[model samples]
Target: MGVTIRPQVGALPVRFDEDGILQVLLITSRRSRKWIIPKGNPMKRLAPHHAAAREAFEEAGAIGEIEGRSRGHYRHRKRKARRQFRCRVAVYVMTVERRVERFPERGERAVRWFTVDDARGAIRNRRLRELIARVAADLASSGRPAAGQPA
Candidate 1:
């Protein structure tokens, strides 16, 4: 039998500084404590992008307007106890309006912001890094703020 690949959703939370420079948010994974985007399994009754938004809020305390269209897809292995399952993640771009001081998983994970270049270096997944680069380039050159970005 072919291995089953799980479907997951993710959000790449981004915000602009006073200088109009873009920054992306990264959260530490609960198990590995490595820098990663906020992500989770698909939720019932919610669209994929909405579920991605929920993951961002719970994992990174980020509240934002997320794009419904996915930026890209990536595959990674999810580890649970002694088992590992391949997971395919569809990532959406979220333009952060603000972040709260408390959230569901606030203390369970560490959250931080990084510049586009820095974010690529911090993320270990090659496909994820490429996605970030592509999104960053598009946003930077677009010459207009996305939904929640500062004008």
Candidate 2:
């Protein structure tokens, strides 16, 4: 029998800096040259939004408040030891508070911030690019403060 595969659900946390500049946290995978948003396997018994927040911390050393709601979905392919696979990821937006450059579980990875436009151009996947564009547009239209602002 062929191995069974299931699509995993994941989230991408995004934030913007002051002056309405869009900034997203990106992680450089040690093995893969792909620069991607921080995301990971779903947590057991944890909601997607909370899981997203946790992943941002673990992957990018980010602490942030979840803003708005989970936005949309995107698909990506993953390669295992000898198999190729595809998974769908649900994206979410969060307002970043702080970023710690160092973390205990930091893998062979480096984290950096990118402008939304740069990020859109950097990622290889077209689906991800579209997702980022849509999310950025939504945030802009919302007119909410980046992180700290008066109501």
Candidate 3:
């Protein structure tokens, strides 16, 4: 049988420092060790945005208020022991409000903050790269972050 395609949720976590410089967070995948945003398949009884937030927390020690609506989506491969599945991820914009020193999966992943230019380079997915570009342009024009408002 072909690998079943399923929808997942992701959080594009961002934080603005005192200087108003916007930065996006990226974390290394547990298995592939690739740089990507926090994401996972949806959990039962949780809203999509909530699931995205949970993934962010568990994967990167991120705590934030996520927009109820998704900004966009991207597809990636979910690698298993000997197979892979394509997952369509609905992504939400999370304005980072807190950072914990230790979280549920702290030791399993490496997290970093990067500028839009760096993010474009870090993320390989074309759709995700375009999403970052749109977010950057929206933020640059409005002087506000992309908080899931059609960015």
Candidate achieving the largest lDDT = 1
Q: Please name the candidate that would achieve the greatest TM-score relative to the true structure.
A: 1
Across 99-144, the per-residue lDDT of candidate 1 in tens digits comes to 9998999889889999989999999999999999998988889853
Compose the digit string of candidate 3's lDDT tens values, residues 44-138: 99999999999999999988788888878989888787888899999888888888888898889999999878988988889998987876676
How well does candidate 1 score on lDDT at residue 44? Answer: 96
Per-residue error at 42 for model 2, in Å?
1.1
In candidate 3, position 108 carries an lDDT of 91
Reference-based lDDT, residue 92, model 3: 89
What CA RMSD would candidate 2 show? 3.5
Q: Of the candidates numbered 2 and 3, which has the greater TM-score value? A: 3
- In model 3, the runs with Cα more than 4 Å from the true position are 1-3, 146-151
Clashing residue pairs in candidate 3 are none
Off-target runs (Cα >4 Å) in candidate 2 are 1-5, 104-107, 145-151
Every model: Cα RMSD to truth: 2.4, 3.5, 2.4
TM-scores, each model vs. reference: 0.94, 0.83, 0.90
Greater-TM-score candidate between 1 and 3: 1
- lDDT for each candidate structure: 0.90, 0.71, 0.86
Candidate 1 segments exceeding 4 Å error: 148-151
